[model samples]
Target: MVVSLKEAKLYLRIDSDEEDTLITSFILTAEEICEEILRFPLSEFEEVPKLVKQALLYCIANMYEKREGSYYYMKNEGGGMAETIGIMKIILGNLRKESW
Candidate 1:
């Protein structure tokens, strides 16, 4: 779903296990992820100046969602999590550029 970075982060924090499952289920492939974003439930937050749902979708498609609120270092079996974060950064950056 299209959401602000803050909203997405908050959603991730709520029941990481469940959210991860949702993210995993939503993304079977990169293309699927993009398609899913197009289907995202729109929100008022989407009106924000800088928000790239596509970037978030790409990241989610690539990696297994992390356990919410993890503090200590732990091994992420799905190594693609980092890639996802990178994608988010890029998406957010692109959004910022658009707003400018």
Candidate 2:
């Protein structure tokens, strides 16, 4: 099943138990991976764009961090920033690929 981001966004708002779990897992796992990346001691040595990408992914995957239209905080558990971001982007990329 190819799910567009728009479709995923719609699914995100549904309150079904199964959909809730799936959405939570998607966001949480991405956040975890981003957290992992940010924790790395060598992260500074990498490209700034890569770091930004990680940060962005972390931000996007975290729906709860956002409140009233702005991101507020991370869930406080998971991988560092980099890992979370990387994982999110990877997931998003994969999801995009699935549409093709």
Candidate 3:
């Protein structure tokens, strides 16, 4: 749980407790996606890097905002979300552990 429920709520602009469970789930999903992208378990790190944390925030926020969509439409619609994901991917790539 790199992103706490409080942080997720704050990012989501959710001020009530009614959707806490849902928000928590989104946070977990985001963390899993981030870990997958990084090719390493986030728990292994003593402290999550700031860039990683930002990436997680973006991922969670994107998921929360677009839960209704079956897939992320990454074409021509301002491209903000797609660009965010692209930035996250680059951050994850730089942070990923290399195995020999």
Per-model tally of clashing residue pairs:
0, 18, 0
User: Tens-digit lDDT track for model 1 on 32-71?
Assistant: 4433333432333436333554565445534434435254
- The TM-scores, one per candidate, come to 0.32, 0.28, 0.80
| Root-mean-square deviation (CA) per prediction | 10.9, 13.2, 2.9
lDDT of 3 by residue, 6-99 (tens): 9888877889999888888988887887777787889888988888888888888877766666434544343355665677788788787675
Query: Where does candidate 3 have its weakest 10-residue lDDT segment?
Result: 70-79
For residues 10-47, what per-residue lDDT tens digits would candidate 2 score against the true structure? 53454345545455455455444443534432234344
Worst lDDT 10-window in candidate 1: 91-100
Cα deviation in Å at residue 85, candidate 1? 1.2
Question: Which is the leading candidate under TM-score?
Answer: 3
Please report the candidate that would top lDDT against the real structure.
3
> lDDT for every model?
0.44, 0.43, 0.78
C-alpha lDDT (0 to 100) for residue 83 of candidate 1: 53
